[model samples]
Target chain A: MREEPSQQIDRRAIRVWQLNGVVTTLVFAIITATLYIVKGQYNWPDFVSYITYGLAALTSIYLLVAIFVVPYIKWRRWRYQIYPHEIYVQRGLIIITRTVVPISRVQHVDTEQGPFLRAFKLSTVSVSTAATTHQIPALPVEEAEQLRDDIARLAGVDDDDE
Target chain B: MMNEMRHVHKLTIILYVFQGIKASAWSLIVLLFLGAGSDLNQLLNLPFTSFQLTLIILGVFLLVLIVFSWLRWYRMTYQLVNDSITIKHGVFIRHDRTIHKRRIHSINFTQSIFHQVFNLTEVQIETAGSDLEVDAVLKAIPYQEAVALKEKFLNLTNTHLVEEELPIDGEVEAVDEEQVEEEQPIIKEKKISIYHLLIAGATTGRVGAIFGIVFLLLSEIDNFLSEGDYERVVDWVSAQSIVAYFSLVFLYLLIVIIIGMIGYVNRYGRFSITRESEMLYIERGLIEKKSLSIPVSRIQAVLFKQNLFRMPFSLGAVSVELAGGEKDDKEAMQTVIFPLLRKKEWANFLKELLPEYQEDLSEMNHIPRKSFTFKALRMTIIYFVGLGVVHYFYSELVLVKLGVYLFALLGLYLLHRIPAFRRSGEQLVMQYFQVVMLSKEVAIVKKKDIQALETQGSRLARRLKLGYLNLSIMNNFLGRQFTLGFLSEEQLEEISEWYISGHHD
Candidate 1:
């Protein structure tokens, strides 16, 4: 109970999470179908198709829930707070982890864009520490840069290259 | 420089020869594995006997290795002069590295079992801020010489240390201790009771290993089974089924605990931490003894850790974060103060070890709600992957499936125990629930220790008024980073302002 409790990440980020979920489902479905069709031509055992079909059912259920049910929950859960002295992050619905990064300890701050995030006109701010790297994924591009600058400003890192 | 280039102990030749043999043997093994030496005639497309040529080539390679080893041994020399240590070594190209005495954080004297047989020990020195690198390693020095070098490197001479050196190491004649009273009698903690050591050992990793061996034996149970053995087992099972099941389980538990106890007792035998002057000396190990000396100032951090069972009993372990050590090298006793300590005992222990470490914050606050949600995604990913892998391996095992489900419950419970941080001026204080054992760890680090600080955000987190912040302090090559997510936007801005505002001057 060291860091103060705080808020969630941008709600719009869930749309990207949803999109990611759907893309994964599509990819999984495509791979399974291609494998089944190719293996079918080689007179594969009939039971093998049954296994693939069972897998398809499981993947569908998983992806469907991920795309439909998870995005909102994820949006609601992502939260962080920063004080003059320390930065606090707590996220994770399943195995919740909370990290407290002291402002005085920050080394570098930057923003990153993935293909999907770029399409959505979004960027993710990345914070680097000696041991591990932290990311705040899915902010509008300008906002992401601003956040990076703000963190760099706070951490007193003058070599700001954003 | 030429006049000062003195030869090392003559035994270095023997050390080099052994090393050369080990290297050449590994290379030969690799060549054989690659099938390059299977049939020399076939490999070389030769007309005459290739077996003799292959033998000749191998002999030549071995000879070259020996020559190179000898040259390396001959060239390797170190000197302690001008308040610095310089080690100059290399066969083809020369390397002369000198480190000033002030930067020398630690000088450890070590002796492997083989070295002990030869009455030789190695002295390794580490300069400050050089991660994973030793300033100099003077190998195969006599024990007395190594001790003297350690003292001269640090400019300390204590006869008490000499008297205490090589405890129970049969051959070293006991030194007269009449003047030992002149030095402050080195403080020694009570030797850990065998009972507590046994308890701690059972709770260590050995229990898991014992269970693994038991399960492996069970998998091979069919190999021991014949028709008569099966019939006898069935007859006993039918006669006293419930009693037999309980007895078997009890026997299994007993065996695992015994195995763990044996391992811990053997390894941590005569575990002792003694403070003499400005350094802490750790002496442990049953068979091949190890004695090490670490200066107090070189300690970076203290980690108070507890496994799942230990937490319930308030019996946690503490390991010091050393500033410089080689990567993945297991100097177990050096890192550990002791394997088991009651929660009530930590304050006194830390007071003895690190007087500068203290934390007191005037006010505190909780992390924002989004912190949990954002981190939940990361945690869920690990659990999901773990479950998927376990399911793939043991889909039909109902017990294993139940265990996986049980782990999920544990995971959820852990998620609820996310850590928080507090800071007062220059020091950051944090208390977090470490996933391993659901143990709570409170860490206090100074602002000056921090190497980096940063904050990041995904679009959705920003929408939900969330951000991720991470900061690190230099400890090892990879600094220790602490992260907490889902802070409000206002908090992030305030933090940024505070961090950058005062540092400009």
Candidate 2:
């Protein structure tokens, strides 16, 4: 926990994360609005309106946090480094997680690009073992591809069964 | 070697028909609820009565079902090639599956009442992969043929030299039981006696389930009785003397115990484990007898688990985690090697049955006492939230508050004792409590078997110099994860470094 991984994800990851946060906040806003509409259409009790108000307040607070606070913290904390025998990754906002995936146990490595990532020229590299998948999100597209290739080459076709 | 395709036993059609009926039981119930014997006949403009119409429809449905079952039985065939078994089945869309002898992880045989009546057996073959479904199923085969098949496959590539001519109907000549018996290099064998079965049943800890079922039945009975009758019954109960009430409670407990015993006996009455040929053969069940052969190489880890009742008696169950198999509703990805054993017997049991997993687990490193602060704080928050919910429902019960606090204290105490780990040679022995109450497990996993090692920490945990460790290991298709929280950051680093460097200190 004292030392961090050697590398950080693409700086543009902040924008991507902010976009994801915006979409989540929008979904919450829609849910709160629906609750309000339902409360108005039905002869709901007073507590129902209070619930709607509380939900709206919470959603707004989440929206502010998502836009201004989360993306930067997430971008700053996300780190990864590839060693000869293992891959180390550090991530998460509230609960920081450090993961070690042994290279010999790696089953496959893949690079993925969603619309937002593609627009930002970024790709997410996911390394899969037999049981779990670890992802380094929002890396420069070429760098992500190179990382995937490096991991796949280093993983090398071990004969042991998972 | 069976180079030609052969059909299963002729009883498969009958078995398939019964299976179809069982599968469509919901629709049959719905039809009965529709009640074609009633005034619905008047609503229909047909010449025949609704009852006769219903009968005619049912007869046609039965005919179709019989035809489908026959077709399914006719279409299904299997052939054993040099190193693989190829199965082709399905009535409409053909399914061809080839399972290599080397890849087969387990061969399990199940005998249902129907199979027993007809002297047939159902064979299931499992392979290592991501698929949750059994790789191949040979549904209704002669009991002797099933045994021979299991023996042959479990023997792996040894039978290539004995390429005996196949019989005319493709039925495997039952290998002489005595001849095959001599070939087994059995390392150890253990069988549960009737006395142990009774003890296991008594300590199954399923009294809660029996009580729940009884309560559900009583509540359902309320629907059939009039309110006045219900009140009279209640009044009669309330009017009983204290001795009678005590007797009633005693009777309820006796029933619970009896039911638990019966259930346990039925499931594990004839349980046995035999170790031979780099495989562990497990056979259990009194009526629906099931025999499973697990290749020792495929086992990912060994687990020793103790429930609350079993813990008091120093009894625990031993199970092994394997990668791919049909999702068994009862035990999921684990196969129990020992349903009940004394705590002291575990070392000897593993040494004899699975020498690869035998390791000294006497000296486990406990987490720092400071780690308990985070664990206790988390438990307190959860306790307060649970108390809030319970208080919302029943505010007048002071005993509820007292019980909740006491329960919370017990949980914190248990948490205080858990999250211990030790590395020995190439294996890590982890001991922890499950999310459920009073159940603890210790897993002995090889370093190579672990998929990933993860350490996580929150701000509070960081301040306290504590972290959580999660280890992933393949179990079924998706795998199972074990989490141990509230470890010192240095301990977390040491473990992670050991995993990465494959070095033990």
For every candidate structure, what is the RMSD over all alpha carbons to the true structure, in angstroms? 10.7, 5.1
> Model 1: how far is B192 from its true place, Å?
3.2
lDDT of 1 by residue, A124-155 (tens): 88777655566777778897788788888877
Q: Can you write out model 2's per-residue Cα lDDT over A10-71, one digit (the tens) per residue?
A: 99998988888899989999998998998899978999889989999999899889889999
Give the candidate number with the greatest lDDT: 2
| Candidate 1 lDDT score at position B95 | 88
lDDT of 2 by residue, B293-384 (tens): 88888889998888787887888889888877745536545778888888788888889899999988678999888777666678788878
TM-score of each: 0.60, 0.89
Quick one: best DockQ, which candidate? 2
Measured against the true chain A, the candidates' chain A TM-scores are 0.87, 0.92
Off by over 4 Å in 1: A1-162, B1-71, B129-135, B155-191, B209-263, B276-278, B326-334, B358-411, B414-429, B436-440, B452-471, B483-505
Q: What lDDT tens digits, residue by residue, belong to model 1 across residues B76-184?
A: 9877674566788889899898887667766766566767888887667767655444557776778887777667656353452444444565533434344445445
